[model samples]
Target: MESGNSIHQKPVFWQESMPELRPCHNRTVTAQRTYGGISAAERRAGRRAALLDAALEIIGTQGVDKLTVAGLCAQAGLNERYYYEQFTGRDAVLTALFDGIAEELASAIVQALQEVAGGSAADTPSAARENAANPSARRMRPETRTMAHAAVAAGIHVLTDDPRKAQVALAVSASTPELRSRTLQTIASFANLVAARGIDFYALSTPTPDPAIGFRATYLVGGLVQTLTSWLQGDIDMTREQLIDETTDVFVLLGEDLAQRLR
Candidate 1:
């Protein structure tokens, strides 16, 4: 079989593709305005944002199936009547929540890459002088390795930081194509930066079609998401730093020549 097609007749992200988020899944009732001195308009907006946040937290923790308007109200402590005031149904909330997650992940990736680049930058004048003196002693950018570590660290930090969202993003990957695509797209974008270092990333990202590189990429991305998620869930004993180090090592082993430039 194909690599992304299931090695041993196993499915990949099939259940998550169906956009299950809805108003009815939320069992919680939205509470009325609690703050003492807020305007009616302000209170309405606050309640709306709160409901959205509650929906994300719920979806991020429990699977999409649990993301009903009632559930959102319960989680946000808003009355059931307030749900329709902002959103039409669970799908609307899911769209908003998913969009939020994507933005968060993108920001995290950019930040991580920045950290790694910053960490890699070292000497200015003296390093140049040294490089001038020795031809083959090409000084690695101080930010290179730092970027590698930072990329891995940032992802882990985000996943482990929130127990509920962590599970939602991680375990849910095994069933939902939508979630999987959102995540893989993020991973692929990150990989692309590294992949751009070479003109032939398409060819070199894998060994042979006989070996199924597409599946390999999926496995790596999925494993990265799930592993960090598991760590956050307390299923794994390794530290975030340890996981970062180990994962970087794994990238090196699999990415062959491509992983080095990312470092």
Candidate 2:
């Protein structure tokens, strides 16, 4: 038994002197060799991204209810066959669309936080003192704060930047749980950012912080969703900036009311 194990150990020890062959890289290379390549899957994912982009553009132009694969294909510059290759139907595409939108919003939020946290050096003692007292203080620097706001604004623009996408986010909030959750999440995060900057918007502090704050966030977010949808439905006559400004006001009030309720 010892001799048999020693035989295997000799080759294993000798292998340490040569280049290591990781299974993942080895398997990938071997698969490519056996199947003739990486270009296929890479190209496949690219087409899918393009298809989704086209779908978003279509939905932005034509509302969710009217979004069809053929319609998306026409907007995407791909044909029916390509659409079929990537998605089964309008349901599948919408599911993919929600997933994509969620990713974009999440990325914007995370990137804003990361960028703010990574802002440059401060020379003054006051700046250093602020950092020691509250680590995230640097994130509120003029440029950094502007970028953070821009990220949220960009996310808001994602839905509102295009008429069709805005229509979908608002319209489907009630009908689709995923869209509702995503929209609310973005609104809550944006509210938090604005609050941090001392800007007026939803719940600053509260005794029943968990539930009350949550309710406030939902109210503010849901209101925006409803407002945007209504506007798309021609129930409201406000411009995009007007809607965003009103939303900020609603959040500020919600934030203060939440604190009072908590107290």
Candidate 3:
């Protein structure tokens, strides 16, 4: 047997200037390689999207209880490792899916509002003329009515056009205790968005920080979500357009009333 000191000796190859013995950059290159024109990051993103889609299918159909890591991986057509790569666990997947749907709805509504606002500047005179002719019909300012309709229609389409998204956002999100808490927090965030938009549109004397403004905003957004969930569940029977119209009316009425009270 070799002595302990002999075992510590460097091998002859260590004396040679062996570039191959140095830390290899092959891993870095391989990691970034666009295999079949898709980089590793792109592949990861694709897997993440697939997982989210799978979560939507599972949660929307089987309920959140059925959304296990194994079930998610199976639905995504991905390995368990891929699921772990994108999400810490089942709750993370649900949260991400819900948040994505919420963001999509919020973006659609904001865009619709912005489009109406932009056109209002050009169309104000005609709208004003119409309001003058039907003064009794103009409880809600023409611009406010237009904005309300645009925002409501956009939000309804986003939720209903893809029923799965609504199911995930409304039903499944409230299925589990953890998810219910998350949903409440999301309601608060959406309420803040509503308050900010109301401030900009109604030019309310009460600032967004005012409790009354906060209360109305929360009431509007939270009530809308509850009503939408009921409608989606058949508890409320109405056509898509009718739903949009009725929701728009509530938004305008309560909004104007709250603005007046604040003033």
Q: Local error of candidate 1 at 160, Å?
A: 1.0
TM-score of 2: 0.55
**Model 1 Cα lDDT, one tens digit per residue, 27-66:** 6443434467885557766777788778667766566778
TM-score of candidate 1 relative to the true fold: 0.56
Positional deviation of residue 92's Cα in model 3 after best superposition, in angstroms = 0.9
- Give the 10-residue window scoring lowest on summed lDDT in candidate 3: 1-10
The C-alpha stretches of model 3 lying farther than 4 A from their native spots are: 1-31, 121-138, 205-209
Error of 3 at 40 (Å): 1.1
* Residue-wise C-alpha lDDT for candidate 2, range 1-263, written one tens digit per residue: 00001111221111111223347744732333213465555655666777777766666666676677667777767767877766656655665565455455555655654554465424344346544554344444433323334444555676665555554455445546654665455456544443443322223443333654555555665566667667667788877655554554454445555555554
Per-model TM-score on C-alpha atoms: 0.56, 0.55, 0.79
Q: Rate the local accuracy (lDDT) of all candidates.
A: 0.54, 0.52, 0.72
What does candidate 3 score in Cα RMSD to the true structure? 14.4
Q: What is the C-alpha RMSD of each candidate to the true structure, in Å?
A: 11.9, 14.7, 14.4
Rank the models by TM-score, top first: 3, 1, 2
**Candidate 3 local distance difference test against the native:** 0.72
